[model samples]
Target: MKTIEIKCDGCGADITSTGNCFDYRLALVVETRAVQGPSVTAMAVSLPLDHDHHLCGINCLDQWRDRKRHEAKLWSDWNQQWKEEHATKDPSGRILAWQSPPREILDARRPEFEAAALAAFPMKVTK
Candidate 1:
């Protein structure tokens, strides 16, 4: 017999699915594009007991959703601000932009976004 430990992504709680039957799995596909290059898409599927984004239960799932929403809003705010500040405008106020802010800048702040979201919705032990 072998033993493996899995942790929930939302709450970082240990998930013991050996005898439990209410575990939930979520499949996600992420697409990433560079500021001026081709895009890359990746798919992830939750396995039997192994998944990158695992949740202990419904509460954790809710928390995860909240965090994701917050993070998305942050990104949206950044983009909107950047566009307003950097977009080139003609006499008629017609704005033109070339994917402002650049990918490198966004990538550098990825950790900050994650941290802010986590801080707003800290993980809790669900055991």
Candidate 2:
């Protein structure tokens, strides 16, 4: 639960917050199902995100929380879909590591909408 000011790698826009998950594929693990048989299993990952934290006006804190929630939901959905679509008969692969949003020097986000976002995730300053 770390929040910090960072630039977004994708759009170069200052994002107020971000959520990351470090997912990996297991070694020699195969998942099977009636619908999708012989699927590869991926392991959970702990990714770090450096989101923005600011108090520009009234009730800004609450808004930030909402925003963070949205981010979390987005990540969760993406991961679930990815696992089903990209499973490899087994997690038995070289294990490719990748970041969704990547990294940035500064995060860009609107003051209005951004406030609600920060509230979504808990804050922990690693730096």
lDDT tens readout by residue for model 2, 16-107 = 54349542211122334345666755478333434333442223344444555676665566565555555544366532553343233113
Instruction: Give one clash count per candidate, in the order shown.
Output: 0, 32
What is the lDDT for 75 in model 1? 92
For each candidate, what is the lDDT? 0.73, 0.42
Q: Point out the worst 10-residue segment of candidate 2 by lDDT.
A: 22-31
| CA shift of 74, model 2, Å | 0.8
Each prediction's RMSD to truth: 8.6, 18.6
Residue 84 CA displacement from its true place in model 1, Å: 1.2
Which parts of model 2 are misplaced by more than 4 Å?
1-52, 89-127
- Residue 122 C-alpha lDDT in model 2: 37
